[model samples]
Target: MIRRIFPYPVLSVGFFATWLLFNQSVTPGQLILATFFGVTSPWLLVRLDAPPFRMRRPLMILRVLWTFAKDIAQSNLRVAKTIIASPHPPPSGFVRIVLEMRSPYGLAALACIVTGAPGTAWISYDPVDNVVVLHILDLMAEDDWAASIKTRYEKPLMEIFE
Candidate 1:
């Protein structure tokens, strides 16, 4: 009985919370509408085929989040300094990293992390080769950047998702 009503309970709760936060009201009508949409959207979305997701180590997720946040802040500072100090702009280049992570979800999360931080953008990823091409604003050491991504972010994500 409960399963039928809440096919995706987590998604339903997220939707309801997001609606309330966006609307910024707790009126009867608002609650009714949020509840209706929250319950319905998940049911509709469940039809789509999604990859199997399982967190092997839940505690590692927090570590990944913290590392990502720190990297973003550091990257912002580095980029800002480069922009302010450099009269002749540093040469920007693309670095192709050979990745060992095979999980689609893990790869997607890595894409977000790499692209979200300043000065770096995800150019393209070759799933067949398991290689990610990244465009960096200030390309100093190609090997160092690749190592940093693998050690700082990719490794943690692998632990959590794979």
Candidate 2:
């Protein structure tokens, strides 16, 4: 009974708090609405046909997150330097990278990592060939960019999600 009532207890509490915070009221009506939102939201979520996901190596998350943070900082500095100091416009081009991991969750995470970087963006992904085109602001070498994405993001995402 408890499990059915609260599929995700923490998420329910978060929704409850967020509703109250946004409304800025503890009146009886607001409280009832907030409570309804908190409970029904999870029930609706459960009804969605969302794909199942299981983390294969849950502990690897910390390492991947650290890498993402460090790289974001470094990429921001590199992009800033190019913008502020470079005499000529930095070379920019798109590189196609072949992805091996097929899990939707892993692919989505990879997309986020690539698009989140300051000087790089995810242009398009071809599902037929499992290839993703990434636009890089500082295009030194296509092979280097592809290799970096494979090493820094794709591999870890595959390990965790696939």
Candidate 3:
């Protein structure tokens, strides 16, 4: 009986907590709505046949967060210098990176990390090829970008989510 109601317990709690946070209230009506969504969304989502999420090494999340913060800070300064201080337009191009990690959650995290940094955008990911395409403002550093992404980002994410 409990299983039928809370199909995904963690997801249910997340949905509930997120709703309450967005509303910033614990009033009766708000609680009702939060409860309704908390129970229903995950119940309906079970149809998607998504892979189960299992974090093998939860402590690695701190490393990923630290790396993301540092990269964002450095990228911001570099992009600003190129745009505001340079005389010439910085070279920009797309580069393809072969990815070994297949977890959807890890891929999503990777997308956030790449796109969150200044002067770089996620172009696309091809599942069949297991490759990710990224457009970077500094094309001359394409090789460095590819290697940095693999080691600085993907490696940590793979350990965290896969």
Candidate 4:
């Protein structure tokens, strides 16, 4: 009963908070609407055939998160230096990376991580070939980027999701 009522309680709470923030109100009517959205949004998503989210190793999340934060900081610095200090414009190119993560959730997370970081943009992903085309502001070596993405992000994500 509890599980059915709160399929995604954390998401529900977040949605409720977002609703309150958007409305900028705590009146009874707004509260009721917020509560309704909080409870029904997840239910609607489930009804829409959303995949069940599962984390195989929750402990690995800390390590992955730490690495992600460090990478973001480093990438920002690299991008900033390239833009500000480089005598010539940095090389740019699209590198096709073959993704190992098959799960939709895992792939989405990887896309977010890559695109969220500075200097890299996720252009397109080919589901049939499991390849992602990423545009880099400062192109160095394709092999190096592939190796970095595979070892640094994909491996850990695979452990977590698959």
Error of 1 at 149 (Å): 1.1
User: How should the candidates be ordered by TM-score, best one leading?
Assistant: 4, 1, 3, 2
C-alpha-based local distance difference test score of model 1: 0.92
> What is the C-alpha lDDT profile of model 4 across 1-162, one tens digit per residue?
877898889989999999999999999999999999999998877777857778998888788789889999999999999988999998899999998889888898899999999999999999999999999998899999999999988999999988
Per residue, candidate 3 scores C-alpha lDDT tens digits across 7-53 of 88899999999999999999999999999999999978888898887
Q: All candidates: CA RMSD in angstroms?
A: 2.2, 2.6, 2.2, 2.1
Off by over 4 Å in 1: 27-29
TM-score of 2: 0.80
Model 3 residue 53 CA deviation in Å: 2.6
Q: Where is model 3 poorest over a 10-residue stretch in terms of lDDT?
A: 138-147
In angstroms, how far off is 84's CA in candidate 1? 1.8
TM-score for each predicted model, relative to the true structure: 0.84, 0.80, 0.84, 0.86
- Write the number of the candidate with greater TM-score, choosing between 2 and 3: 3
Per-candidate local distance difference test: 0.92, 0.91, 0.92, 0.91
* Model 2 C-alpha lDDT per residue in residues 92-120, reported as the tens digit of each score: 99999999989888998888888898999
